[model samples]
Target: MRARSHSPRKPKPNSVMGSPKMKSKSKSPQKKHRAVINQLDYLNSQCHMEGCSVSIVVHSTRFLICRHQLCHASDYFKDLLQSKYGSEDFYVTVSSMSEPTPSTQFRWFVESSIPCPALKDISDETLETCMRLSRRFDAKGLEMRCTKFIVENACSRQPIVALCWLNWALKHKFDAQTQASCLPSVARLSLTALEQHRHMLTEKIFSDLLAAKLRGTYDKAVQVFRAIHRMDHFSVEVDRCPRCGRTRDGMRVKVNADPCRKQIGCDRCHRESCEIENKAGDDLQAFYQCPHGLVPLNSTTDECHCQIPNLAHHLGSRYYFRSENGTILNPPPLSPHTSRTFDPAEDTSERPGTSYKRQTSRDMDRREQRQSAVVVRLEMLVVSLQPEESVRRAEIVSFGSSVILSIAFFYIFTMLNAFTTTNIALLDKSSGCFEKKISKYYGQPKKLWERFSRAVSLCSPRLHSVELGAFANTDEFKVPLLAPSEDCVVLSLGIGKDVKAERRMRDRMSQCVFIGADPVNESNADLFSQVGKFYNVAVGHKNGSFRSYVLEDVYRYQEVAYMDLATFIKLNVNRKIVDQMMMDVEHAEYPVLPFLEKGGELSQRDIAINIEIHRPTSEDLQAFVGFLRRNSLSQQWIFINSEIHPFFKHIRLFMINGQNKECRRRFWEN
Candidate 1:
């Protein structure tokens, strides 16, 4: 197809060929073969990538020029194309892969379906025909562009692939314009690149959240640490004595027990007998230290008898310890292997970027803030938590999927990152499971948390609301996000429990936007409004509700027109508080999620919420808490804080923020 070069004047071609005509006729075929080989060599130069590795198939078709030499099943490439576009589109693309000339390509574009038999059963002769056709049409340039695009677009979801394509595109001088146009073709080549890639995004991707959490503040850090634990599958706590199987409690006693309750044995009854009941479960109350030493399996439920440890045999006996052989016992380690695993009792060394100390100067204020309180149990650590296994490979996988190459597919990474994973939770304390996943991405973290708020409300410390402590609380709470100002060190609550903890907290917070309750009037707004206002502090009154909010009420509650009072609060407070919120509204807290999600008011905050559970069964609580958990509002401390704020000191503060504001590992132990 090379045009002959000539001077400005038209040449007399016959005059020159007259003598050489005989020679020219003999050389044309040989010259054609050499041209085909040269083109193939050129293509080979660019086919260095893993995906592009292919031997030049010397194929030729009457109407085709460039033939792909890849040797997979015809269905294989068809399938890959089908995934990127429809099966129809794939066939269309492949149908003309062998054609080299733009002249025949027009027919390919016109054909409804790609002709199959052409190279479907590729043979040496057919390959050669394809190569001949390609040279005639000079289609290699077009083919190369198309192939590169399809593969790259298809791989957009795979971080590795995406990174590769990014690098490749740059290497080949493919501009963004080319990337946009060719991305679809790339996607068509790699079928699996769809939503499946999201799963590949790990904790490493969310280092920003971690950085924010570790910036300095403790409450925020604790909240974020818990969240990181949740995200990384390193936070949920389940106790199982990996060493033994006690019919009663699953975990083994790693250490020797005190002398008083010495019925140590690996029988079903002893397993749970001494273990503390975390949330709630089956009771093991059927034993008596009677002479026979007989122990009933369960107090009233089962009439079955369980074995008792032969404590009389030895001094420091474990469940597995034995004497003269009697009945075979389930194996138990000599002692318990009960030391903490993921979330240990001992505090980990503080992460870098946070170091602050306590101040008695704030003591008087701390004393004043230390009003009445509930005997806290595992404060702040527990939220809508699922066992590490709850997070699915599929969920993350989708985040990185392609389909993005197509303009039809929305490339929304921010939305994927904003998802709050709280459902499909395997409770550390109880049994029961939930289901389902949401499609589409939401950019704001608060939106995801609001969704999970219902789920979190299922547990004891139902989330009334939450705020990031100028840190990780951003997903659920509306706090000011700011860059670090001054030395700006944030100490753990235990490390620096100022009596005026609230004031101290308010004073020291920096690198954060202030998030406070805007005091929206609550009496008139409907459930949704109240919920929205509650999330964003702009509302004038307590934005959220009392402790009576229920799932059904939210679903069936009357919708009331509302104003943006909560927005005002955020602008006004300019300070974020990580306090326990009491939202026991009859129906108020459920509906405002949409509103709170908007206006960025729900950007920061973690109000350790105490929502009133009003369902007839545990399923409702489960559903509610599951919702909250999915939304990223982990259910922290679940309890009533104050009945009334000090403004009415004569009585009490209902669900007021805790004065201690200090949450550390020893919280439960203390």
Candidate 2:
């Protein structure tokens, strides 16, 4: 589909015609001086090129121009003109740069800087001519305008023009927008037109067109197939051979046959011999060669490739679709392979050229009798091996099905595991920072003897009086909460409609600075103003804009800014150790537990975390408590309250162990 190209012709010195002399008919000396002065003025007015000390003559017409303008347009022109011409010389003649003349295009190119060229007024051919000149001179702006005019106007009106432009664009590597405009028009060309202009198109363009056409043809065929199948009620029947009474799947093609055996078996033993096997194989082959051969339900017309004569009589409309007289779009070519030339001599049974005449009814009956006798003899021997073959096939199928199911189940299990895992960063061994895999259960279990001893001491009055830690039912170790003082740092997340709890904490610890945050607390902004800094942004599992559904029905759903606890703490608190933090976000606490465990923001303080668990199921509550208990950084919890409601519980006063004396001792010993 690629086209051949020719290089631009170089200008010849003799191509430029010599300028004619103006005869002086005026008798007065004043008139002659005025004429010379007028000619000089005309030259200066027409030439706009900078550093104009010369006139360039092309194809007999002379254009007075500047040296810099010519150089700016092309490196070839700059090198040629600057190397040959001098400042003293005022005139220079150049040969033919274009056919007929380059004067018209050259004038436009030099004068284009004075005013923007109106490309709409020019004919497409004229525009193309200018484009070629611009291409040669490397005039980028002129070429772009010319290309735009061709694509926007000419290509839409005339397809042939588009075809020509496509070739030009490909060769020159035109801008992407112009090429995109050419592709769709070229793709819609008819097959005949495509063939005619194949050489003008690039291989990629031609292939894309062909592929689109092929897909259209295939889609139409499928439509016809579906229509026929839907209209016919009994199209799903299995196909059977009339002569052998065998279905397609039960029979196979024969590779080797003995022509001499009019009977089913070979000359030796007449039982299920090589000759009978060959007969079965041959019958299978003949069925396969027929165009009306059976196809599976899940297959398409292309996969079947049926082309048998009298297919309508043999298999009815179920086997094929008649598309020429049909409404199907872009039907395939006639005679899929090649039309068979009909010859009366070849058709006649009496012909003696290369084949025998057709058998009479009497001859057919005799052959049938011999075939029946051989089939009866072979049936006994073949029937014995049928059961064994079927059993072997079943075993193979079962094994393959089992393997497929196993692989499918494994893939599903892996995907479920990945989806359920929480998004959290782990502490790196070198940095002691949370920056790896999501935290699951962080610390190791306690000894059996220690658990037994603690259980035996349950009779003590202090043990009964002490508050239970969060996840007390689980095996995780506990830490008690420490009361906050006046100089403590507090971070309040998800403040509900009421600010009574927050106000009470603020009044008790007046010296502490509290940062209160709530997504839906814009109406109560005035209340939190006196407490500390208040933000309307919601805190969630991650930093993103999450959809916050308003239950009031008037405003509907809206999106709000959400930042995770770790990020909010990092961005606002930086390296400060939070003394107490309270969270009441509806079911948004699960994803933030690991962040509090490993993040450096609260590692130096006994942070009391008070959070309300909304609509908590048994499994969810257990998992939440277990996560808090297993955290290595937060080794203690004060109290977990279940007095509010069985389903909606709260961890009222949970805290981490702030004292690191034991930790330092262990580190030094290690």
Candidate 3:
């Protein structure tokens, strides 16, 4: 290969190719030739040298590289050099400009002793150049190294930078590890950032990221609720106004006069008067003023005679107040000397002049009043905080209920939407085959004319249908849009010149595998081959030679090899289940329908049939409807193509095997 000419210039100080200038004073041609050979030998044995067998010229620079080394390292090089017309003098040019240039990176990659070079020493630009070259050359080793570097280091960078790397990896179809490692960066991204870069991500990745975010938010909310539940047991104390003697707490006021009243008194004297005037609201005061003498108090101080005993009893027992830190705030245990007596007769507060009966009544009333007052205060505190606790609990319950309902509604909507979109039609057995009463046509029509009219009027019970295929010509067909399956197999019984319907089905469901058959081996083979496997034989009742006619011209016919439906299915499908079968064999469906019914193929598995019945007579029509009814196949869609013959119409029908258990489970039970 010829190297491009360049102006003579001094070599850079750090050039890997070294100085290109050499001088020799020897006059003899033999000595100069020997010196040139020595120079080439030195270049071949250098650190960057792979071999001196082939020259790779990149612009003005040329490098000697080995063919075997390049071929082993890259698929592109292997295929190029192993081809019939490949020459040893071919040149590889690197057009893109980089810091070290593509030529330098290529030389380093091929000549390095290790499979992967030390990436830490290489600059980012040089690494990027290596990745580009590796992908371009289909170098698996280099691609793996690049992918490893990205997976290990990309997420450690800024989120935006990591997202850029992730987008690049996804676009290039990197390994799953690389994609997984980059997904964390997506989770770290803010909502606004994700929205801004949403166009860069695939739909599945975007949804996964959103789901992760929602899960995290829900977890945080749960943590908050747990903290609230733990801290809910703390008690709140209300401070009293020194002058008015009214209690005040945050956003709430409790007056001694009217505990349930919302409004406050106008002045301190008014509050005092209100407190003295409203005896009904104060249970303690009402107990004191009871005219029936149910409770009695000391006339001097108006204090309960059993107050000390009640306080001592409460403190010594299990009834203890707890602080915010859950520590017990009960007073010190009562000493034997200071402990009050529970019996009224042993009390020290009894007067010497008091009668025994009066003293007993006064002590009992005072003890009861003190106990009631203590109970009332505790109850008031509990009632005050009950509403807040109820509201918080309600909030948590509401949140949980909403989440459960949302999930249930989503599943219900998804199921309903799937059924609705499929356009499924369930059989109405009570309605009978025709719209009229079954008694009206109880027996089969005796006359041929009556039978023909009855067959024409026959209406298969269909709930709904969806049309699919090209709208232009007779290539258009209708079938229920069933759920997609990954391992779906479709059998195409005939292929004339058009495969529009098959192509549309493939577009809708790319996972479906199509096996097409046709008698003529003309353009039909090429057209059907684009979508799936095409067979040159025809499909019929039995495996034998059959006469087939062209759809365009019924008179033109040819003898073709034919295979039975069971044999075709067994040969192509391992599971013996055909998801869909499309047949348009001129007028051969009349004989094929009987074979399918007698063989019990429709009963064994779920198979959706889309057949174009060509030129059927009254008897043929009646037999066709009878076959469908016997096989438990419900018609989903029917089209009459009367363009060819008005009297003997070509009826196109799509039916599903409703009797099959698997069919009902997959299409109806959902």
Each model's TM-score? 0.19, 0.31, 0.32
For model 2, the superposed segments whose C-alpha errors exceed 4 Å read 1-54, 81-123, 171-177, 215-302, 307-670
Winner by TM-score between candidate 2 and candidate 1: 2
Please provide, for model 2 over 217-251, each residue's C-alpha lDDT reduced to its tens digit, 9 standing for 90 to 100.
65555456544533432212235433344454765
Residues 243-327 of candidate 1 have per-residue lDDT tens digits of 3532336643442232224443333323453342211122222233544465433312232232334231212222232223433
Native RMSD of candidate 1 (Å) = 27.9
For residues 1-670, write the lDDT of model 3, one tens digit per residue.
9998897887675564674545446665442111111111113344245332454554344555555656777898789777533224455645466657645666555543123222233334555555666777788877777777777787677888778777877777777677778788768888667856876777678778877885576556545544553453232323554336665456433322222342333234233432323222111121243333445221113434334444645335434444344443454576654423234343455445756766776787778768866875765554455665987667867998999999999999987775564323434441244324323443442332234324433544433333333212234454633444657888888877777667667777788888898888788898789889988878877899877786434447788898877777777655667777778887778777754553466445545677777755667757765664544333322221112223344565655654456655555455
Candidate 3 minimal-lDDT segment of 10 residues: 33-42
Give the top-scoring candidate (TM-score).
3
Question: Ranking by lDDT, best first?
Answer: 3, 2, 1
Of the two candidates 1 and 3, the one with more favorable TM-score, higher being better, is: 3
RMSD of each: 27.9, 30.2, 35.5
Report clashes for each candidate as comma-separated counts: 151, 6, 0
| Candidate 2 lDDT for residue 216 | 67
lDDT of 1 at 536: 22
**Cα error of candidate 2 at position 491, Å:** 32
